[model samples]
Target: MSVEGNPGRRLLDEDRLFSSDPSQRSVARRLYAEIRDLPIVSPHGHTDPRWFADNEAFENPAKLFVTPDHYVFRMLYSQGIPLESLGVARRDGGPVESDPRKVWRLLAENYGLFRGTPSRLWLDHALSEVFGVQERLSAANADAVYDQVQACLDKPEYRPRALFDRFKIEVIATTESPLDPLESHARVRDSDWDGRVITAYRPDPVVDPEYEDFTANLEQLAEMTGETTSGWKGYLAALQQRRGFFAEMGATSTDHGHPSAATADLDPAACQSLLDRALSGAITAEDAELFRAQMLTEMARMSLEDGLVMQIHPGSFRSHNQKLMAGFGRDMGADIPTRTDYVRALRPLLSRFGNEPGLDVILFTLDETSYSRELAPLAGHYPILKLGPAWWFYDSPEGMLRYRRSVTETAGFYNTVGFNDDTRAFLSIPARHDVARRIDCAYLAELVCDHRLDEDEALEVAVDLTYNLVKKAYRL
Candidate 1:
């Protein structure tokens, strides 16, 4: 019952059914065995670059495991645990937990809240494989598990760079704002370290009018790029310049986190007028959205010219909890998934670049219903469009399975980019990637067993889907 007493054992019993049939289960096990130790290709994620740049030993288990993870905190929040108690830092400089072990106990007490959730799978995997915890994280074994993890984390082997090497991560991408100077990225490059952790250009603050301090962010972008961000043409040029700067820093892609899957194809004059209204702060919510939509099209056009991959992650109702958002700020696990429409919303952008062979736009959605209805069909036909793997809310085992089942018929394995562990928790990278590979193997096993695909074909597709597809998709 204690992690210290019986180390190096699995939390769950082997009898647990991840797959239904014994034959398919065997195939899945074999398939997982092949890529189980393969190098991780984390093409897109939200992990802090400073962790790798600094290469400092993590302070404690709770801060490393519980606090920063939205999946962990959101579940705790759903069970009536205040975010402030879980050591979630406030944006307005309010007080929060300073004792990491106390936060760990609170999370351990409420661990059952995530029993059937993906968080449980990730946690168990991290505990067993990463920290070598044998016992399950119940209230009884919480302290023991915490102590063991804390002890291990205090070691130099558990440092970010060491773990990156131990995890066999080939490349990891951290998202960065346009205003960021990428000093950490520069440090990573200049250091003797061989780990390939790159930055992704996220232009939300400069592009999205609703983003906090949008005006100031625009001024900063202008200052960095020496382009007049006040005008429409100069704004676009500034963005292009910043994107080039990111490209030089090893960025192969640009990410847009828009509110919806909206896109527009406004002419130059209309775009300038919209920008003027937005700058004057006279733009309505609807106008702001339209401008964002138009920017998607503009970004795609730029991608076509520059050869950088484009990623659109739309349909998040970000900061749903107004109080939590106001107190703790963004990404405190208050963001909820809403139904996203891709068909009509992306028509403008697709119409302009859908047939273009030079452009590559990978689409990720929070709405599962759109997988077969919108995403698959779009990716199936458009030369420029490719479906990103199950993302964010849907980046679970069942979610990945659902994605394969739903989209495989139309988009196929080649049309879809392989898995990307888009996580902020650095330690969970291996666990998340493991879950994805397992689910994909299970899906392929099912296909092989059903006689839909031969064993040889399944093996090839599994390897490609797990490794090659992602590398090619992200231009790695």
Candidate 2:
């Protein structure tokens, strides 16, 4: 019932995630106060557009917190809890625990599994600050907390659109495939809600050969645009048409989640041959990778024409656990970080578009090793390249600190975009953003104390990192 006997009586410390030195922590507190409530410029994320469009109340706490977030369920799965028990549906529509209270109890009991994790910080923040649940979640209080959150969800003020406005999100972008009709986006645009929900073009299904139903995706693309997708020129035309369509539906960016940061610039005939092989479904793994690489360059060129910002998220060996993938399908926390090469891998694309001033390409990596050695140098030099915020596995306070330390000296602040939540859990957006702002302010405080930066400049940089940089980078 009470958190008094716990290690910390208060669920969150007012000075959490700050410097140890009193002077620097004081500076951090002041800087955080300045920009802590700035509007979130969420240029890229995975929150469902349908929620904001429909303005529906979230079903329950377990559905809101456990089922949708891979960060939550994957950690529970690692501790030997079946995903089905946590209400994660299987691809075959197999039986899963449907009782939300049971799922919440399981998560609350195993909350210790997330003790030192970003998930813990986010969950605690969401519980205490968002829902006004001050007591630490445990098996004893799980039902009480669930009932409180469910009661909040039932209120008109707690619906998706209401929370979007409450969160002060300036502009949020949700990713969608080329085959998607974007009816949800149109609904958001046409509605009187006034929440800015836009879409980002993710052409993986049609671009990546290893994607399931690649040929079928191409055929669907042909049907979507009246182009013969069998031919190379027609395929390109179809993609360009879809980009235009997405742009019309309020999309300002394109996202690519390739396995590697590979890029290629093949001749026209060779490109046609590769396209043929890809369409025939007779391509090898290497061929698929090469085709994907060439498509990256092609997309870059198209970005120049359409003015959609490009984002490349690479170096994840996706679906690393074959059994989980086979059971639950993709994006179920099985994606593992692998060694990524950005210097050589991006050379081909950069060679062609490196000098193009009109293009904006944001590079994201799961490989932290590349941040200082490759990504920072590359971003510092190229007109088109800018480093994305700490992403996927690295969207933590420590990871953010590491990224700022690794890239800021070489690339400078301007060469890096500000934070993007990149999340599926709607409730976690504010918590994630809060963590980033606190960590960034702390970083600025350290720089100020070291006499490397003046207080005024640090304050300005703090505002930029919190709000201005993302808008400018994403052209929001």
lDDT of 1 at 447: 87
Compose the digit string of candidate 1's lDDT tens values, residues 149-181.
988988999999999999999999999998899
Clashing pairs in 2: none
For model 2, residues 1-476, the per-residue Cα lDDT tens digits are 44323535667889999999999999999999999999988888899999988888999999999999999999999989999999999999999999999999999999889988999999999888778777878988888888889889999999998888888988899999999999999898988878899999999999999998999999999999999998999999999999999999989999999999999999989999999999898999999999999999999999999999999999999899999989999999999999999999999999999999899999999999999999999999999999999998999999999999999999999999999999999889999999999999999999999999999999999999999899999988
Cα deviation in Å at residue 432, candidate 1?
A: 0.8
In model 1, what lDDT does residue 454 have? 90
Model 1: lDDT equals 0.89
Per-residue error at 248 for model 2, in Å?
0.9
Looking at model 1, residue 382 earns an lDDT score of: 87
Residue range with the least summed lDDT across 10 consecutive positions in model 1: 9-18
Question: By lDDT, who's the top model here?
Answer: 2
Evaluated at residue 411, the lDDT of candidate 2 is 100
What number of clashing residue pairs does each candidate have, in the order they appear?
0, 0
What are the RMSDs of all candidates, in order? 1.4, 1.6
RMSD of 2: 1.6
Off by over 4 Å in 1: 5-9, 12-17
Q: What is candidate 2's CA lDDT for residue 8?
A: 50
